[model samples]
Target chain A: MADTIDARIWRGGADGRFETFSVPRRASQTVLDVVTYIQRKLDPTLSYRFACRVGMCGSCAMTVNGKPRWTCRTHVARLEDGPLTVEPLRNLPRIKDLAADMAPFFDKWAKAGGRFVPSTDAEADFAIVEPASAERRAADAGIECIGCAVCYSACDLVSWNPDYLGPAALNRAWTLVNDVRDAGNADRLDAVAGDAGCHACHSQQSCREHCPKSLNPTASIAGLKRATLRAAWKGGP
Target chain B: MKLRARAETLLWGAQRASAAVLAVCVLAHLATILYAVRGGLTAAEILSRTRGSFALAFFYGLFVLAVAVHAPVGLRAILRETFGWRGVPLDLGTAAFAGFLVWFGWRAVAGLFA
Candidate 1:
């Protein structure tokens, strides 16, 4: 706790600039720790969002040194720069002081029909699905998203084309696409296809590289492309 | 002739389609020379045979026009996409290239007719 670390956290409204804070650096101190220390001890009014400090909640994501990351798991020592400069995630509407508005980000998930729609009613017989099956395997690979908005912030396509469904939402839709029990697979596939959806993704692989969970959204998007193309061809042109 | 961004895409599609046509035309032209000149066909004999072939002349002329339009538009996009820069200099260069393709290809196509 002897070393003095300079922290620059984004402060104020949508048009705000970086507000600087200097604090005593501690051993094994995560970025979330430093931010918490500044808010609690230095300034009580400083605003930031975090639920679970252990990184499962996916709420502490902020851009560290121009790259989106889960600040809860990111160590202050690992950042190579002299001072850690924190900014709100890019391509999302900023609220104030490191917290960006996630409504649009999450709304696209609904618009993409990412939620599961059950096929059977209350009295229907249970359908058994093998965990080793191809559909189940595809779902297993992409179902770990905690809605952190990291992939959404990392995608350049989202920055360029604001209407694009983004990686996380599309990834969720892909998982649903493989769910044989879901009644809305065809509608979901049709919704996630075409220009403003997964087709617009240039395979930049930014989301793949930045996901803290190491989940590959590109593979899921590619799967959706193949499925949609096959479905489109089989049914008609 | 339109300059909208959407028009650019259509022009690019046309250019690509034309290049495919030119590729076939070029191979056919080379193969025709190789096969037809086996018996040392004279210049007079070549003219006599080519003069009546309006069908061959039209097809070759279409190939010539395609090269004229395709070469310049592709160079235009290449300059913009690769250099990370775009404006008057790039546009002028593309226009000049199109003019060059049209002039050279048309000269050849006209000679085939006359």
Candidate 2:
């Protein structure tokens, strides 16, 4: 077996090109380790992002061999036979080598009204939500999303429609929509009801297929679609 | 002017509803065509069965209208996403396509009745 892996990484902004580095392969090596070796041992200026080096932060997501995945968890053994191609997430502006500008991604979340609007005062008692209730379960299903843009990068709709709210934003909205304690339902529905919102998702399930947390943003978006329809029909937001 | 959120939601709902109608209509239309041609029926025979039958005419009329409603809405989403074309012109263009679909579809259906 070959002891070295070829890592071809994107090395600049929008006009950047891929730069290849050969790193010594070891047992149980991850894509992130390969990148770290190249940055620390080979070149000092190779830029990327990662935190919590486990699967929790979701900041280590990158396009590995043309598929969006968390580099911290993506072992090199899973890749097909070729040089490992690592690039920044797609459908976003690249800032540097392997670093995508996340402003658009986060902006969509705000635009979709992903923030929870507080309806209670500080002196108020904690709202009790039954854990087994349908709404709570639905909210729980998508609540673990770490804001990783893997789903966004994988979404074909986002690629085609640059203004799309993307999966993360819609999923955030969906979780909130189902939250009984959340006071932002009406405004969130209004925000996600339009062309750039939940209506724009084509149900491609690319987001569902690529999410590191196994969250189905596609289903969340469908929930948003239904919720928005009722809200829009009632003319309430 | 800001888009009417309710109207946009209704548009999405209409597209889905029309799509549901199209699914049934398309299957029934195809099955009818297959059944009509199965015994090697002549063109005159086919026309004879459809020409004066109010039931067949109504079914086809509904089918045509469903297609007219369904296709243009789907095309509207496609045009906006793929071509980056939106606003009044895109809406008007899809509406025109719907009109054209209805006209052409009814003309073909009407030929059988004629």
Candidate 3:
């Protein structure tokens, strides 16, 4: 194995270009480790975002070799074919070197009704939801998303339409839609039903393909389509 | 805005429903053509089979309507995403395109039927 690996990392915003640095390679070293090494040893000025190095927080997601991935989990061995090129996630404004602004991403989430509206007040008893039920199963299928925005970055439609809700938000809405305890069904359907909502998705399955959790937002979007169609036709939502 | 949101969902549903119809219509049309052309029929022979046939007229008419519904909605999406066109003018243009499809398609069907 080569003693050192060439690391080409994005160093600025919008018009920013890639800058290459050489880092010592170690066994079982991850992409995040390489970046951290460069930031600590080679260039303290190099900027990036990461909290949990174990991939739980999902704060360390970046574009690895032109695809969105969790750099904390992406091993150096898997990307050894060429100089590992890392950049901030796509379809978002760059804040700085390797850091994309997440305001638009979270804004779309809010627009999609990603937040759950509680049906019961504090005095009310806990709602019993069966894990085996169809609705609960559907919700559970998409509930593991850690807000990584990998699916959002993978979505081509988001790049085309700025107003698009993207995959993560739609997936969040799907879980809420299927939740029996959620009181936001009608309004949530309305939120995700329109031109920039679930209807805008191209059903290309790019979100499903690139999700680190393997959650299928395309299926969730399809469910929203069906739900929204019923709501529109029957004059419910 | 609320009306447009409701209309968007309905439009999406209409496009999908029309697509299902189109799938069947396209397959049946293709099958008919392959069957008719297998032994090589002359122009007169083809016209004789199609002219004054209620079944062919009905099938082709429905096919034309489905295409009229399906194509322009797809075009609306394309235009909105590609050219950033929206609202009244874009909807009007897409409806006009649908009308053109209906006129052009029905005229051809009428030629064979009449």
Candidate 4:
């Protein structure tokens, strides 16, 4: 019996080759399983990053057959065709073979003021905000991002404009936009506006489509655009 | 930094502002046409009233201005994204195209009114 599983892994930095791996076939195997088998059993030196074996952690995202996906969630049997090409997530700096540097991706979040800068600190009591309220509801809807960089990897605008605050960051901004207690509204808008910010988003919705959480980062981006436009017009914080 | 982003930002602002102007112009033009056609006016008669009036000139001028500002910016972005053309060459080419739109659009409106 010939042990045969044709998998093409991106091998090297920016300038890399799609080195094929003959991963052994297995039942109920996943894309991560294939990558793991290649890294562990076949080639001990294959550089790839994965935290949790499950889909909760978004660390295992890779361009599987030209689409950004959480490899842990992607079953190998479903995509066990002839050629399986894996590349680092798109629209970001590639650090190694399959691992992309996520610093810039998270940096934009900080720049967009993704943090909930409360009016009061830990010494102060919890300010009561009804979950049923419109603002809280909006915030709650978009609060589940795992920072997997899937949306960041899937965006074309981020690819075109390197300085663009990718969808996840802007989406994070939108959540804070609705946070009534968050005091950095004006500052956030200032950070998110201009050529390299939320205004740069073309509303292509690749982020929404590729998001593992089924969250609409595009809608959140639209929300930010509308909020920023209104805030700008009104000169509001 | 790349000029494409700055150009795009300016274009987005232009698109929004021109869209506002276009909205009012479209409504006014439509209403004016409806009013004019109610009496079954001839083209020559329509020209006689519309011609040489500063208001008509202004309205048409604003209309042309909106088109001039709007079309080429959108076209440039669409072209760049679709064709993968970037950098200073594409930027200059797009800026020139926008200028051409403004010039030709004003000329057409000028002929219609002037």
Most accurate candidate by lDDT? 3
Off by over 4 Å in 1: B1-114
Q: State model 2's lDDT.
A: 0.89
On lDDT, the stronger of 3 and 4 is 3
Which sections of candidate 3 miss by over 4 Å? none
lDDT of 3 at B29: 92
Query: Under CAPRI classification, how is model 1 graded?
Result: incorrect
Lowest summed lDDT across 10 adjacent residues in model 3 chain A is found at A186-195
Question: Which DockQ values do the candidates obtain, in the order shown?
Answer: 0.07, 0.54, 0.62, 0.19
Cα error, residue A58 of model 1, in Å, equals: 1.2
The ten-residue window of minimal lDDT in model 2 chain A covers: A228-237
Candidate 1 lDDT at A56 equals 93
Residue runs of model 4 more than 4 Å from their true location after superposition: A1-4, B1-14, B20-49, B52-59, B68-111
Contacts from the true interface found in each model, as a fraction, amount to: 0.00, 0.65, 0.60, 0.07
Better candidate number, 1 or 2, judged by DockQ: 2
RMSD, model 1, all Cα superposed? 8.2
**Per-residue alpha-carbon lDDT of candidate 1 for residues B2-102, written as tens digits (9 for 90 to 100):** 12322333454466578899899899989999999998999888777777588777888788788878888766655544554466787788778878877
Can you write out model 1's per-residue Cα lDDT over A1-237, one digit (the tens) per residue? 338888998998778988899988888989999889999999988888899988799899999889999999999988886888898889998888888888999999998888899999878888898999999999999999888999999998788667789999999999998888998876676677644576656688999999999999999998877666655545521
Best by TM-score, which number?
3
For model 3, the DockQ equals 0.62
